[model samples]
Every structure is written in C-alpha cells, then in structure tokens.
Target chain A: MTHGTTSPHPAEPAPAPRRGRPRDAARDRALLDATLAVLAENGYGGLTTAAVAARAGVSTATLYRRWSSKEELVIAAAALHGESSYEQPGTGTLEGDLRVVLREKAAAMTGEPGRLIRALIGEAAHNTALAEALVTAFLQPLYDRVAEVVRRAVERGEIPPLDGVELLGEVVVGPVMTHFLLTPRLPEDVDQATARETADRLLPFALRAVGGTP
Target chain B: MTHGTTSPHPAEPAPAPRRGRPRDAARDRALLDATLAVLAENGYGGLTTAAVAARAGVSTATLYRRWSSKEELVIAAAALHGESSYEQPGTGTLEGDLRVVLREKAAAMTGEPGRLIRALIGEAAHNTALAEALVTAFLQPLYDRVAEVVRRAVERGEIPPLDGVELLGEVVVGPVMTHFLLTPRLPEDVDQATARETADRLLPFALRAVGGTP
Candidate 1:
C-alpha cells in the first residue's frame, strides 16, 4: 500500500528517525486519524498543520518533523483513509456485478473517506507528487478491481474482448465523479438512492460497451 | 454564453456593478485573459485574485468591485476562456462526427484553456458557486454540442433513439478528462497524437453505448 511518496505513517514509518528513536507507530496513527478528522470537518482549504497537531495532541513541530509539507501530509492521510476491504462481487453477469461494485464505491463516497478523496483530487491538480500518489495508491486499486471484473466477463465470452476494457472504470465511474464534484447537493443526499439511479442508467451503456446485451 | 452564477464577463456582464456605472467590457476580457495566463503558469492552488489583477493591469480592488469573490472571478474567466466556435460536425455518420467532435475537444485540453479548465475543476470540488458555474457554463455547452450530434444520429436511424443521448458526452469525454487531469504528463507532451489515440479508442465505445455498431 503506497501511503504516499513519503513514509510517515504507522504502516510505513520513515527508515531513519530524525529524533532519538523511530517515530512512534501509535503517534503516527493518531496524527493520520487527526488529519482525516480535520479533513472531514473542514475541506482541504481549511486543513492546516497546526490544527492537525492540536487535534492529534502533538506539537506542530512533530508534524513538520514527520512530513516535509502539508501536501505530503494530506496524501499520507488520503492513503490511510482510502484503505478499504472492497471485494469484487461475483454476480455471474457483468451488469449485475458492475451494479454491485459501483453501488459500493458510490456509497463510500458519501462519507468522510469520500470528502477526503475529493479534497485530495482537488489538491492533486496543483501538486504533482500528491497527484501521482493518488493515482498509484487511491485510484489504481479501484481501477484494478473494476478491470478484473471486466477481464472475467471477457474470458467467459459474456462480452466481446474489447481492446480498452481496462478503461472501463472511466465510463463506469466517471459520471458519479462528475456529479460529486460539480453538483451542489449535500453529501448525505448522495446516498443509495442517487447511487442506484446512476447505476441503473449507466450500467446498460457499460455492458453494451463490452458488447454485452444490456 | 452562460458566464456562471456571477457573470462579470462582457459576454454576460454582472447584473449591475456593485458601484460605478456598468463595468468596462474590455477590462472583463483582459482580466479573464490574465486569469487564464496565471492559471496556465500556476495551477489552481497558486491562483490568487491579486496575481490575476496584477497580470491584467488592474488593481485588486477593481476585480473585487465587479466579482464578489475569487471563485466567481475564476469561473467567469473559465467561461470566457471556454467560449469556442465549435460547430457540430455533420459527417453524416455518428462515429465520424463523434470522432471529429471528440478530437476537437481533446485537442483543446492540450493548451492554456485546457489548463484553466482543469484548475477550475479542481477548485470546483470545494467552491459551490464555481461548481455550479462550471456545470452551467463550461460543461453544459460542451455537452449540448455533443448531444446535438447524437440527436442527429438518432434522427438518421443510425442508432437507437436511446434516452439520455444528452449524456453521451459523459461517456465519450469522461475518459479523456480523466486522463488529462490524472496523468502527470507535461501539457506540451499531450499533443495531437495522444488526442487522436484517445478519440479513436473512446469513439467506438461511445458508439456502442448508443446502440450503434462500432
């Protein structure tokens, strides 16, 4: 799991400590949790290193000592927050499984994890390292899981062996991402109802894209 | 010509200036052009109203006099920059015209306008008014143009008169937008070759989605 370009998290601590001993694993977890907490309450623009330190019960110097910049800190927090146990549902049919997977992904976007993800995406535009980390750690796994299902459908001859099946996620998840970013709806309002509606509407096109009769 | 929630551009000037007689149309154009220039050099994170005003040869107060906030200024700038003379290509085939239009849209993403567009997208994730403006001004026009091509295709019996042909842009343009934002490629490197390749790959899927044989 790529925590980020930097290794300041408990899961992957920095190799050499800048202090007397290696950074405390528990402290790293607290700091990351605090980072996410702050992100959840106040979007990226409101997140500050001092605020995070105060929330985590650590000094500002500790945070600066651990992470080089706020961008690095945010990316680390994003990766930590993004860790999920999303299992690919094997529903026999491509559309059925896609609806399940997409619904789950969409549901996740309604919570703190989703907000942080959006914040990270916004920040990533200006910050290259964060952008790369987001692609590698956050987006790539989700894409890989979606790609696996499409690969299986192709192997079963359920759909045509499309050349760009790998990009299925772009079509599958793009509209929801667009809606999340551009829509002025409250996050709670984008619940299972909205997710289901979008899934029902877009799944046919996704299935058809792979040459499956929707 | 939808200039956003707060229209300060000449195309759609503010309702009435907060002070003084109506704002100068030429100043609006200069500020918007300067906004794009600043955005091209520094992504959204670095964009500030002061920099934009300085670049446009105006005082920060002049900008504040017209627009309520920086978010409004950026969106108006984005809308002004996004104004294009792209006519719907009538190649008589859905795939052919889609390829033409998609290629044109993709090519635009390789320049300064594209950079500002991406910056606005990132910023929109947080700014509600900007988000609304983006969907209304930037995306809605582009979507309308693409939807027209699909409408024509349906009329000609080229594809099933499927509902939501209006959303063909989401499926068609989604992949390219995803690629443009997430990929860490230098703007100059995203040339005609990359644009053509994306257009070719996605056009097939887009056609299939609309029930047209690729």
Candidate 2:
C-alpha cells in the first residue's frame, strides 16, 4: 500500500526499445518481399502486417511508416512482387506483338495474381481513393501497355480503329480475367498454340466490335 | 442469461417462436423478399440476416429456421430468385429462337433484377459458399440455358462446335457484365438498343466460337 513506491518492473520493460525511426531501405524491401510471400502463402484477407513484419524481421511501425493501410501495401507489393515486368516485342504485325507481350508475362502467371487482383478490384469497388490509386498505379499501366499494342495494330492495319478500345481491352482480357476472377481453377499459362487459337477467335470479334475486319 | 432466468420474453410468451427450425413456404418467400430489399439497400457486405428479419417482420430464429448460415441464406435467397419462365418459339432457326428469347428477357429486364444480379455476383467474390451456391444456382442455370441454345444451333446446322461450353456462356454474358462490374454509372435501362446491338455484334463471333454458322 506504499503509494510512492514504483513497481520494480516498469510498464513495457526497456521502454519498448525505441529505434529512433530511421528509414531502413533494406527493411522496406524485405517488408515488401515478405508481403508477397505472405500473400502467396495466404490470400489478401489472410495476409497480416504482423506476419509481414515478423517475416521481414522489422517493427510494425516500419511497415506503417511506408504504407497507410494494408491495401496500399498489398498493391505496392503486387507491383514489385514478381515477374510483373513485361517485354512486348515490336513485331511487324498486330497478332505478333500481342503474342510476344502476353507470352512474356505468361510463365510468371501464378494463381496468386488473379486472386489478389480480384480482391484488390473488389476492395476498390467500395473505396474511391483506393480505386483511383489502383487505376492510376496498377491498372492504368497494364491498360496502357495493352492499348499500345492495339494502337500498333491499328497502325499496321492488322485490326480495326480505336472506336472500341475499352471494349477491345475487355475482349483481350475479359475471358482470361473473368475466368481468373470467377474461376481460379484454370491454368494461367497460355502456350503458343492456345494463344494463337485465342487470338484467331477473339481478334475477329474485337475487330468487328471496333468497326474493322467485317 | 443470468443464471437460468425464467423465459419471460414478450415475443415468446407461449410456445417458443421458431427461429432455428425449418421455415415454411410463406416464411421463406418473405425472407427472400426481405433479403432482396436488404441487398438493394445495404449491398452485399452490409446485408445481414438481422436486417432481413427486421425488414420481413420476422424473428431472428424464424430467419435462421430455413438457412443455417447467413451465406447459405443469401445464396438461397438469390438461388430461388430468378424466373426461368420463357416461351421459346421454334421459329425454324437457331438465331430466331435465341433472338426471341434474349430479346424478350432484355425487354422485360428491370433495375431490380440487375441490382440483385450485380450484388449476388459481387458477394460471391468474397464468400466461398456464396460463390459455389451462386455458380451452382444462378450462373449454372444461365450456363445450361445458353448451352441448350448452342446445342440446338448445332443441331440446326447454325454453328461449328467448340470445346468450351463455359467459354460460350461467358461470351453470352461477358460483354454486358463487363460494363455492369466495371462502370459505376448504370444506364436507366438495360436499353433495347444496347441489347440488340450487343446480341448482333456478338452473334458472328458467337457463331464462330460455337461452330461455323450452320
């Protein structure tokens, strides 16, 4: 009952070991790497900051310092996560360019991307800020790359005009994505034969939709 | 709750109100209606059985009576929701039959169906059971319907056969669904012009994908 006597064991022993908030670029990279690791191991909902920090051997504050929320962190991690870097060949033909571009990202096509992409999209559906960030950061770049190929096709007169670029975008990615989003069972790798078949089949519809070919 | 307090709930003064038991037809219909209302108001994630019960003027027990989990109930509500009633005219041609059927449904489409349809698909993304139930109950039916139409088209020598029936299903719904899922602004109507245009534009590709036009 001695009011003045402080406990021998102070609250949070060692004052939680303050590190003075120095920017750890190495820790940040590790955290991002760990985020992808956790994402691949578990889905978007299952991935946690604690797990990422633990995996990266960094304090949780280090993570919070870089990312405002889990969603932002996940998107950033996704951007740097894997073989997202693509090389679309400047083939003389439209189909040639598509085949090259798609085939480049083909092997790196893991199941994780599809699920995370859908989850990110679903999250964006409800969040305006996230949606804008997502479009500007993740989706826009992908769209721009695809649109460039399509534009090249127009220049080569291999396909139609730009009337249905959005629709054309959908036609190219719609089945793959819809299948990915709704059904995760399909294999992601599109081999040459399959890619050629798909191009032959889909390019026609896209052509007509964009007021070309037919 | 307080050491076996006597049951003095005014809501259940006499016979205990049935909440966890099997719900009858009338109760089931009411719950489904309430579910649609809740879904319309609160969206997929915000929708709860409590809201459904409150909206239906039924006890929580009664709400849980027919459905074991909220996921199941939502799926059940959406599963039994569609009207498959149709007058398929044997107009001596596959195109005629498809055009007639789709045109009619398009003509009769309302905002209610569209919203619920979007909500159901949206919810399915997050909830596994909802996803299975939706594909099983809602999407499967649509798939089967379109499959039958394609099968008839083959029989009538309208198109060449393709391997992916599900792919065919996607073609039927994909373009419109693209707008539905991606665009925030919904048109006032499904719009007869849009429907006709979509059906016509997608027809040649659909025919080619299914089988070369018979």
Candidate 3:
C-alpha cells in the first residue's frame, strides 16, 4: 500500500465517522476494486482519483470523503485483500502443513490480489514510509504464518527447533524472489508444482543449513 | 540492478579499444570506489555522475569513458563490489557450509559493499536494465554455488535430491534479503555461533520440501 513518497501512518482513523448517511460499504468495495484494476493497467504514477472515481461510478467527493489521499486509498485497497485466518494443519508432518499454506498463497498471488501487491511494492521503493505501510499491510501476515509453523514444529519435537523460524522463512523465500525479480522466466515458484520441486532439491540444503534432519 | 520502467538491449558492447590511453584501469577502479563512497554517504537518488567523478579525482570524460548513464554507473558500482569469489568449506558436514556462507554474507552486508548492493536493489524499481545487470553480476553466482552443492549431494547420495534447486535457492535467500530490505533484524539462529542450531531446525523442512529423505 506504499503508494506515495510520504509519511505512512494512516491519517486519523477515518475521524470517527462524520454525520453522513451510513457510508455505503458497497461503494467502498467498488472503489477498492477499481483501484486494483487501474493499478494493474497503469503503474502507481498513473493512478488518479478522477479515474478511480469514474471507474468506481462514484463521485470525486465520495472518493475524497473516505480517503484523504491516494496513498491511503492504496493502503485500504491492499488491506481489503484476504482476511483468511491462518489454519495450523495438524498433519503431524511439516511438509503437509507447509504445502497447504504455500498453495493457498500461490493461488492468491496468481490473482488480482497479487498483481496489486506487486504494483504497491514497485512503487514503495521510491517511497520509504509508504513501503513500510505496504509491508505491514500485505507481507507481514505471510511472515507471521511461517513463523508460527516453525514454532509449532519445535513444540511438537518433530524437529530440534531453532531460535528463529523467521530464518527458515528467509532461506525459503530469498532465492525464489531473486530469480523472479531478475528474470521473467517464472514469476514466483509458489505453486504445488514449484513448491514440490523446491521441497525436493532445496529442502536438504535448507534443512542442513538450519540443522534439522529429515 | 533493477533497471525498471523500460530497457533497450545493451548498446552493442563498448566498441573495441580505439587508441585513447587504453582506458586507465586505475581510473576505473577509483571511479568505482568513488561510486560506493557516494552511495554510502548520500544514498541512491542523491547520487550523480558529476559527484562520483569529482570524488574519484577523474575528469567527467574519464567517468563517461566507463559508464554511459547514472543508472549504468550505479549498477556497475554494485557489481564491482569485489566479493566475487565463492568458497565451499571442506568441513565434511552440511552445517559447516551453511555457517561459512551465512556468516560471511552477513558480515559483508555490514560493510560498504553489502550496504551499497542493498541500496541498488532498492533502486531497482526505478530502473529496469540496471536491475538486470545487477542480478546477472551479483546474485547469479550465489544461485550457481547452491545449485552446484545440491547436484553434488544428489550424486553422493548424501540426501535424496528431488527437483528445483533454483527454487530452493530462493527459499534460502528470500527471507535473508527480505529482512535486510525492510528491517534491521535477521534470525540470530543463522548467526555464525548459532548456525548449527538454526540449521537443525531448517533441515527437515528444507529436506522434505525438496523431495529428499523418503
């Protein structure tokens, strides 16, 4: 949601509601959807309130009334995506648990949700505080999930738990992103097919690197 | 080297040595050193070719002799970081390998070379071709080393290798870079002293994910 080159804190929590007819949740949704659409079609530099208002079929005043700026709207649009609770799979094996998690993310990444996110991350670079907000809103949950799983594995004694599950997350994620970022060959190796393949060749190195044995 | 936005393939490789003083190799080194110094002191957007040339004590023409554009200069600065060699420890154990690599990178990251590289990646979104060049020069060696190790492990039957060594590289590198990119903290688990502790936790999941340990 890091949409602009400015400070990132959300502006005053919607100001506790102005005296208006119950804000149309539908219009809000419409505006967000339109934002995602337009973000994909055009990079962050091109996203405009006029285009979003027109596309959402709402008035400019309606758009402005809710969101103070494009950055706020971008954050809201990003935050609106995927409110699913992380399910801890009690499959007794780490592989099974991670498989379910990675696959779910893969699907989500392949959709409009992922595209909007990519756009946000791209823009965030030129904007620091905004990038922070985007990271908090979009990517933090994924880290939390991976961290919890490693913790659960340690508690279960399925593996000799390390001090940080977060490290495990890094080893798994770093190269995939590096390759994806560098080349256009494959976007993210996030699916069952890629994940399965990753599990086979990389897991050993990662396992040993972390000191867990299969 | 995220030369984002748009790119045209390299402008036909620097047309072979046309007589002018053989392109002062010493001057090239000084300019690169200047580039890193400027990056560390001023950060990315604030960097310029004139500043670099001035710092290096070379004329602007000397600077232009090496790099055609600022993006080109920045990307080259990142590439010429001098951490080119990859060494595999013959500690006869997987944990040993992980320790050497992670510790070295983390330490390197604390210095100018690593910091400058990170800054370049941050700038990747603004320039496309620079990103491409940086990836080719820097991250590729990392990918190659890990991939080679996986190939050896499979051949030795140290672990049953499955598939996708490249993807595995991502899994390993992603979190490390992600943390460095966004936050100051990394998993202490991968610290030089505690690498084995981290490796044990990471191994089984990594191995299983890669398709080994059947």
| lDDT against the true structure, each candidate | 0.71, 0.56, 0.58
Rank ordering of all candidates by TM-score, starting from the highest: 1, 3, 2
Candidate 3, residues A74-158, lDDT tens digits: the string is 8877776654523455666665555555555554443455455545655664466667676666566666666676668777786
- In what order do the candidates fall by DockQ, top score first? 1, 3, 2
Using TM-score as the measure, name the better of candidate 1 and candidate 3: 1
lDDT order of candidates, best first? 1, 3, 2
Clashing pairs for model 1 are none
Candidate 2 DockQ, CA atoms: 0.15
What would the per-residue lDDT of candidate 1 be over residues B3-28, giving only the tens digit for each residue? 43444455555667655456566787
- Off by more than 4 A, model 2: A1-27, A37-70, A82-85, A89-93, A96-110, A160-163, A184-214, B1-24, B40-51, B59-65, B80-119, B163-166, B183-214
Choose the strongest candidate by TM-score.
1
User: Highest DockQ among the candidates is held by which one?
Assistant: 1
| Candidate 2 per-residue lDDT over residues A31-102, each given as its tens digit | 878998897677665888999989999888878877878877776776654334344457776656555544
Overall local distance difference test of candidate 3:
0.58
- List the RMSD of every prediction in angstroms: 5.2, 13.1, 8.0
Stretches > 4 Å off in candidate 1:
A1-28, A45-54, A58-73, A186-188, B1-27, B38-72, B164-166, B186-189
Among all windows of ten consecutive residues in candidate 1 chain B, which has the lowest summed lDDT?
B1-10
lDDT of 3 by residue, B172-208 (tens): 4454455555443322213443433443444444444
